[model samples]
Every structure is written in C-alpha cells, then in structure tokens.
Target: MNAPVDIAKMLQPRPVPAAMLDALKARFGERCSTAQAVREQHGRDESPFEVPPPEAVVFAESTTDVADAVKLASQYEVPVIAYGTGSSLEGHLLAVQGGISIDVSRMNQVLRINDEDLTVTVQPGVTRNQLNNAIRHTGLFFPIDPGADASIGGMAATRASGTNAVRYGTMRENVLALEVVTASGEVLRTGTRAKKSSAGYDLTRLMVGSEGTLGILTEVTVKLYPQPESVSAAICHFPSIDAAVKTTIAIIQLGVPIARCELLDANAVRYVNNHDKLSLRPAPMLLMEFHGSAAGVAEQAQTVQEVARDHGGEDFQWATTPEERTRLWTARHRAYFAGMSSNPGCRTVTTDTCVPISRLASCIDKAVTEADEAGLPYYIVGHVGDGNFHIAYMIDPGKPEQRVLAEQLNDQLVHHALSLEGTCTGEHGIGLHKQGFLVDEAGAATVEMMRLLKRALDPKNILNPGKIFAL
Candidate 1:
C-alpha cells in the first residue's frame, strides 16, 4: 500500500534561480548549505505529510543573517521558510513550494532577563526547557510547556499551549514582544517591555501565531512566573468518561485555579503505563497539578478530590515530592510517543480541538464513541481544564484507506467542535494538515481578510507560500 510520491508534481516544480543561490552562498559562505542531506533535513518535520525538500538550506546565526537571507530570497521571488527545532507536529517547516529554508537553531541565546519586570528576552532558537533552565536560578519560570522541547520561536509561531495553559495561558498571553524579520527583509520590533500599552497595532500578537507565514521571528520577550511555594500533582482514575468529564467541568466551573489538569483516556493510560513502566490502572485518568502556597495548594487539591469523588473518581494518588511529580508528568508527556509505540510502523495524525468548557463532555463523548465504532487504533490525551483535547490516530501510512479514514474522523470531530462553538485547532497552527478547515472554522469573509493581510505584508507571497490559506 505504499503509495508513489510525485514530489515534483506536489511541489509544482518551482525553480529557484541559480543566481540567487550563488549570491546566498557567497554572502553566507559555508553557512549556505545546498547539500541534499541538509535540504531533506530542513524540508520535513514531525508532520505526516511528505513534500520535496527546499532547494537550499541557510543556517542563520542572527537576526542580520535572517534579514540578509530574506532580502536575497525576496530579490529572486523565492519562498522563504523559517526553521527552528523542527518538532512541530504540523508541516510548518516543509518547503512545499520548493524554496529556501532559513534555519535559526544556531541562534540560541538568552538575550536578556529583566527579573524585576517579570520578563525574559530570548532568541527564537531557545527552547522552552532551555529558557526555564537558564532562568531557574532567578526563581522565575516560563510556563508554556508544549510537551516537546520545541524552540521558543516555533512555539510562538504555532501559538502552542500545553498542560500549564489553563493557568498561565499560551504563547499569546505570555509573549510580551518580538523582533521579527519581515518578508521585505526589514526588521520590525513589536510590543514593548511595558506590561500594558495602547499601541498603534498589536503586531506582536499578529506575528506570535503567524506560523512563519507573515514573517520570521528572531527574538521573543515573554512574561515569566515566580516559582510557587508549594506544588503538588495528583492522579485519579475514573469509572467512565462521563465521570471524568463531569469532574473536569465541575473543577473548572468552581474556579479551582489548577495549574495543570490533563485527561488520559483508558487506552492512552494503558499505553502510557506500558511505555513508562508504571503500575497505573488501565482506565480513564485525570492527572492534575496545583501550584500555590502550601495551604492554598492543599485546599485546591482537597476541593478537586471532593469533586472527583462526587463524580465517581477513584484511586486518588498525590505526588508532592519533586521526584514523584517529575516522574508523573514525564509519563504524561510521553503519552504521544507511548501511544505510537503501541502500533509499530504506523504514522500518527495528531489532531486537536477546543470547545466551550461546558460542552467538553459531549464533544469528547461523541468523538470517543465514533472512534470506537470505527475501530481505529487511537489515543486521546487532553488539557481538559481548558477544553482542549488531542486525538492521535495511528495509521498505516502505506494504506490510503487508513489515512482517509483518519482524516474523516478528524473532520467529524472538528465539525462537531465547531458546531459547539469550538475551534478546529486549539494549539497546533494551521499548517498543511488543517488548511481546508481554517476557512471552515473562520467564515469566508474572515479568511479573506486574513489573505488580504498576508498580501499586504508578504505581497510577493515569498514568505512560507501556500500555508494558512491560499491566494
């Protein structure tokens, strides 16, 4: 069932002018790599979609490099795709249109830490864990954890949110400012160190989740949180999905201020236990964390426990020690890889949706039922506290039927969530996978407006062409 790939046809066979490549090589010297290995490496990501590699890969070390490369690309009308760590689940880094990829991984630097301002300015190549480690001594930590050690630039590009988003918010809320290299090769600084401002335009936000479609992010300044005095994590098993959903609803409605509240369906939990070698029960489970003063965390845990009990939750295990908490969350973060392990030699279509908190139960219940009836091997893990859940469908990529079915199931889930006033994508940006759904989620008029904005900024469409939406 392995399908033939028409890479050239898919890429539409766009030719990169040789003069531009020579100029880039001359300007960047050894940093400009036209090697096949480098092109292949920068062309694809964790996404399942396959595409031809870019014509060339430019390793950019600073904002000046990015601007220079972009300026040259603009001269040749060549598409420019920015590359970070390439951990993005969507095909955000793919050179689908046959262009050049500007890699910023070498730009890893912690530019500044204004501890008094509760903010840190960092290069785009800095990963979330890296930032936290760099600032750990400051007693302040960046809270956006998207499971993978994704670069800050990529995280901001995708507007990623993870377990902690329910409390501290996503890149949208945490990011304070940005240094962006526009399509015209001009550097624009958006936002300010000041917390609140009545600026002319919220350009920083406009670029935060632009997915490299609008411009390239060189530096990002993000708000950081003071380490909580007390932090506690808990695991609870539920008799059924109904009980788990109800407990989540009640917890959120009660305003528990839980730092992290994640749901692992029975199947997902079983896979996690197998992968992590833990002795957890094989049932739908909720992993939660509370951060506050010792007394406050204790009170929050007690309230959640009471709510869980009222909703038929059992096996309430609390992990207060650092070691225990790390072990617990490590298992949780490994859920994606663990689930993939359950089905060897299969590709995963990891999709997510966010709904109104009140409708979380209905949306998840319907999705689970349909997936069960479809008999697809899948796992469901969610940041249910924020009404965002992920369904990763393990599909035999060689089989077209499995891929089609997985997409159909995803479409159903997305349409259902949209019907319930939810978004097609919660955290993962609209890369190649979710392009069609973008217009569906946002009306034709809205998407057209977005296109207008894109045309205005990247008039030549040389910036990550054929992403978000098509002209």
Candidate 2:
C-alpha cells in the first residue's frame, strides 16, 4: 500500500551555509536571487507536495553559468536542483533538502540546426513548441511531446513521452547526445549525432531519466522527423471504455501504424467539453491520427475505422483541416487542467501505470471499477496505443480522507500493473512521489545498484537530494 507523504518528516532541509550564499551572490550578482517568491517558484512543481522553498535561485544563461553555480553548490555540499519550466508532475523540482535552484529558462536557444542530418542541438531552456517552430521551415519536427510545453532539458531529464511516442519513440530513443554539468561541476559530453553507436557506456541514456540526480543537462541533441505529407485526425465514440480500449488493442495488434491513438473516457470528455467549450459527445472515445503519404494515410484510417466498427464503435468523425486538428489536440492536451477546473479547489493523485497491449483492458477495467466504487471524482485518459494511460483522482486538499482514498486507488493500480509485467511509471521518472513504487517494481538489489551508481557519480549526494530513492 502507498503511504501518505509527511511534509514535516521529509522537510529535512540541510542548512545552506551563508558563506555559500555570499559566494553565489558575489559571483552572479543580480542573477542570484534570495527572494522568497523566486525560491518558492523554483521549489515546487505540478506535484501536490508542498515543501519549503530553496534558499536561493540562480538564473543560468549559459553552460558556464550552470557549471559555476553547480561548482559553488558542490564546494558547499548543498543540493543543486535544476529548474526548467516546472511542468513535471512527479515533484522533480522540490528542494526538500534545501539548497539552491539553477533556473535554466534564460538559456533558451536553438544552437544548431542540421536539417540535412535531421538533428538539432539546443540549449536546455528551449521548449518543445519553440523547437518545432524554429525548425518548421526546415520541414522537420520533434515529436516527443509530453502534453506540456515542457522545457527540452526537463523532457530529456525525465525521459518523457506522449501521444507521438507510439510511432516516434520516447526521449530515450530520440535524444542523441547531451552536454552535461556533472556532480563535480565538470563538463561532460555523451553520445553523437550518428544514428547508432557501440560507444562504451551509453551514458547519454543513463542520464536521460535520472531526474537531475546524476548531472544537469545543459545542451541536448535530438533526432527529428520530416513533416508528414498527408495527415488525418479522427474520433470515434464507444458505448464504454472497454469498447474503445479493445479497438485500440486491435489496431496495435494488426500493425496499423497509428501516429497517435488516445482514449478519453466519458468523464474526461465531459470535462474537456466544458473547458474547451466544444460539444463533443460525452462517451468513451478514441481520438486517432494517421500520418504518411496520401494513399498510406487513407489506408491506415480505413483499417482503424473498420477495427473500431467491429468493436461497437460509432460516430466516426474526421478533422480534415490543420486548424481543426490543432483545436482537437489542444483540448486533449488541456485535459488535466480541465479536470482540475471541474473540481474548483482540488488536487489530483494521478497514476501513470502502463501495461502491455494485451493486458491494457484488464488493467484499465479494474482501475475504473475501483475508482467508481470508491465514489471519488476522477477522469481517465491515455496514450493507449502504447499501453500507457492516466487515471487522475481529484481530491479536495482540505479533506485528508479523500487523499487517503485516492492514494489507495493509485497503490492498487500500480501493484496490478506490476503483476501484469508492466511498469509503475512509463514516462514519469521516480521523483519523490513514486520512490516506493520503484522499489516494488525494481527489486531491492536492482534499486541498490541504482543507488550505487548515484553514489559513484555524486559522492556528495547533493544533486536533487531525497529524490528517486533516499541515499
């Protein structure tokens, strides 16, 4: 069972020596901020946890700035948390161990664009949308969208994936190389632009999902895909979530090559309808997209529609124009906010369990049953093509019992996924929230190995301390 997080016990803020603060202020001048507002902003993320803020915030404008700030933290034996757009939902940015935050938003820049090779090098602060806009004219796009306009650095750090991952793969596959500032404040580079390599350690990947525990990502190089010549988006209504899930499973099993296959239960659809001001049918639905040549796109759409029809799907609708497609997806991406809005002053305990395609239906069915029986306000949505989905349980923060019930539901969901040979978290990394689940998924020995790696690299244990697993 999942235990509630105790803020008091976890707020073991190590004293940030005044000398270190003075040193950082002297080095960075106005860029170093000790303002409570700035530190509070950097300390919390989208996660529900509320802990004390970091002692200081450093606005890093370049790799050199990050390195120097980290150097001071390393010298002072204080935790250094890397801050991006703070869109992470796993509490990855909280400064539980009190130190300083190095905000990378100022480092926004697309350093190099190799349109010929289909790769781009960018500073950590560049957002996914910004990256796509910068390369749109080159007929290329980065497809690893994590729903949020997350910073490139944060995405790389969390090894994020989204609707596009079913075809384009996650950050682990798209990211080619990184310029990192290590625990000791040394610059390290990993991987190359070449497609494949037999390089020694695969350090690039090792750092990808470390969640800022090992090093700080300063620059990232990621592979890009050509813009689809022919694209089509469609939605189909199903009698129940079961029907929609079965359709998705059939599509994937038959190798339909759907670019994006998303599911939104009746609750999710209603919330989105209210928030986006669209009168979509409040039923379990599948929002799908096809990308390829004209003939190829048509064929894929036909196959998927046939599959849906066999599974009791109806009201298949297409969004033909680019603007229409954008509007639909924009609504989908805002589903989380929509859910929150529905419950005025509520926080959510969201599950990121991902099972194999075969077990998705069973996994989702049991989760839905339990959530409904619990009598809690909840919504279900997912990138179901790849067997990943989210069930967000909205709970009033003022009610302790509601939080407990939500956590219980999440605990059961995660354990069931693990039992079915799935992951506790598919895209979200093990921040403070999922440490227990990580241990349950990866055995004690395996977790110990991870701890060893963390110790080997960060001997001081000052980089994003109290995350993943306590050292």
lDDT for 211 in candidate 2 is 96
lDDT of 1 by residue, 1-471 (tens): 112222344465457999998999999999999999999999888888888899999999999999999999898899999999999887888887888999999999999999998999999999989999999999999999989899999999999999999999999999989999999999989999999999698999899899999999999999999999999999999999878989999999999999999999999988988999998999999999999999999999999999999999999999989999999899999998898888899999889999999999999999999999888899999999999999999999889888888888888998899999999899998887787788788999999999999999999899998778777
Q: TM-scores of all models?
A: 0.97, 0.99
Error of 2 at 119 (Å): 0.5
Cα RMSD (Å) per model?
2.4, 0.7
Task: Please list the residue runs of candidate 2 whose C-alpha ends up more than 4 Å from where it truly belongs after superposition.
Answer: none
lDDT of each: 0.91, 0.94
Clashes of 1: 0
Cα error of candidate 1 at position 193, Å: 0.7
Query: Which window of ten consecutive residues has the lowest lDDT sum in model 2?
Result: 2-11
Once all C-alphas are superposed, what RMSD does model 1 give against the true structure?
Answer: 2.4
